[model samples]
Target: MTATGGAAEAGQGPDQDPIRRSYDTVAQEYADRIGDELAGKPLDRALLTALLEQLTDPRAPVADLGCGPGHVTGWLADHGARAVGIDLSPAMVELARRDHPSAEFREGDLRGLPAVDGEFGGAVALYSLIHLPPAEHRAVLTEVARTLRPGAPLLLAFHRGSEARHLTDWWGHQVDVTFHFLDPDAVTADLTAAGFTLRAHLDRAPYPHEAETDRSYLLAVRS
Candidate 1:
């Protein structure tokens, strides 16, 4: 599945946003180091497999919202789903373009997607939502719902917690970004309120050598 978003709902949106710039500062390094990261994570791969199976149109592009470096977007392609990866960072889009020329990457924001209503067949947000403040979750999900076909599946992976963490540096690069950990119930409620049929909510302990935080995977269908 793919996830999608536009740079902003209005004009005050994602372009050059701190999160975008933060990722931009490390875009090439991130792409070289962790872009193809799903290869080592079994659960993530399994979830994507399930997502791929649920897509209604095999040839249609899936939206990858908050698609950093377009790795997950390419992963979707590896599994046979056409994908369009969207990010707020132009540098990330450029790295993704360089790495996976076969896929499409655009600079966008999750609050508003540029696509026509129901433009996608499926969507995925792999840890992308973690960057947004909780208050924006529903608005983003609402935009998600608007851009997807009815009953289209959405797969989400996120860190689980009760607060947001701000990082001043990452991978040895100076940066400013906030990561939000969320409760599954709250996110599920947000999805329901945004016109989606909650499908599955799964959480797992972090594996060795992975980020030292619990993770949650949610599967929902557009209503």
Candidate 2:
């Protein structure tokens, strides 16, 4: 994958600016911890299965944005989608490539994707958007939309929240990392602003082993 500077750098405020840096610092540990969990977990598999059901065609190219360790990307490839994984952290990209040899993994920023316009048939921004505040959501969605063909499927997953919250968990790498959560209606609004129509949404309590949190999902289509 090609690399470049000047990635839009739009739609970020003080509270959210530190998040990227935190993820960069913890990229490796984050991948090591969550990679295998997401790969074989029944909860994640169920979500992917549901997502695949909404896909319009069997053979379609997919972009797995913020793909950590290529678990979901590899799954999509196995299911007949030409999948490519992209992430902001180079270490995460490296780990993803090492773990999932069949799929393509690239170090790239979501705010400014290197993908050609209308290149992907679908995109998955799973659990990645939670890092940004609500204000930046639409801009990121618009960027994702630009890479997808009209009517292409896009699945986004995140924890449901009534307001933005800052967090510091030691599970990943060193520096403190913060995540922002949004409610379902807010997510739908952002998707609509990005020229997508909500197809289906699932709100389920995470499994027993999962941490206690409000989880929500949305499967939308480009318009």
Candidate 3:
């Protein structure tokens, strides 16, 4: 699933938004293929555990923003956080709910989240921000900050680069989505401007079986 905004209005309007439509079209296949991806990424699990550990109230809801098939969300729940998965695609949300009944999933936009101010204890946006254009990065981050409590931990992962990749076809299905490779320094600046204080930043080369792009992870706290 994908989480994005700045291109259209909120709510389930996939017919009007190419990104949502594309994800909806491939939601099932994406879940089938990527739902268990975290099993192979030890660093991802470690970071997620760190995020949960930092939350002041472990019972307070932790949002898995742009949570595709709810695998990460379910992982957080299993690890003791009250995890809620939010995605822009209705189909993705449906599949997440169907597969991970213990965790809650909602259909919402990243730019305009369907959450009240300071509703979440912490949040994670793994590879979700790449779907958004650079100009809208801070806006979405600001929205995320608005929904998180002060000092709430936020973990973000993205492709590390200065290039933008667009896909017109994926997994035998027609799609129109652009994945933005962001610079860690630029994203750190954006986090600061969005009311977050960076606590950790790490970059790593992709695993041989993974996409051929460098990856960056940032751990920040709402301030």
Best by lDDT: 3
Candidate ordering by TM-score (highest first):
3, 1, 2
Residue 15 lDDT (model 1): 37
The stretch of ten residues in a row with the least summed lDDT in candidate 3 is 3-12
* 154: Cα error in model 2, Å: 0.7
Error of 1 at 219 (Å): 0.5
Report the error of model 3 at residue 37, Å. 0.4
Query: Which scores higher on TM-score, 1 or 3?
Result: 3
Q: After superposing candidate 3 on the true structure, give the runs of residues whose Cα lies further than 4 Å from its correct spot.
A: 5-16
Model 3: per-residue lDDT, tens digit, 1-223? Answer: 4754211112345543888888888888888888888888889899998998899878789999888878888999888888999988888889989999889988888878889999999999998788777777888899999999999999999888989877899889998887788899999999999999999999888876677988999999999
Q: Of the candidates numbered 1 and 2, which has the greater TM-score value?
A: 1
lDDT of 1 by residue, 17-59 (tens): 6676677787788777776577788998898888879888877
**Collision count for each candidate, in order:** 11, 0, 1
When summed lDDT is taken over every stretch of 10 residues in candidate 2, the lowest stretch is 1-10
How well does each candidate superpose onto the true structure, as a TM-score? 0.92, 0.84, 0.94
Q: Score each candidate by Cα lDDT.
A: 0.77, 0.69, 0.84
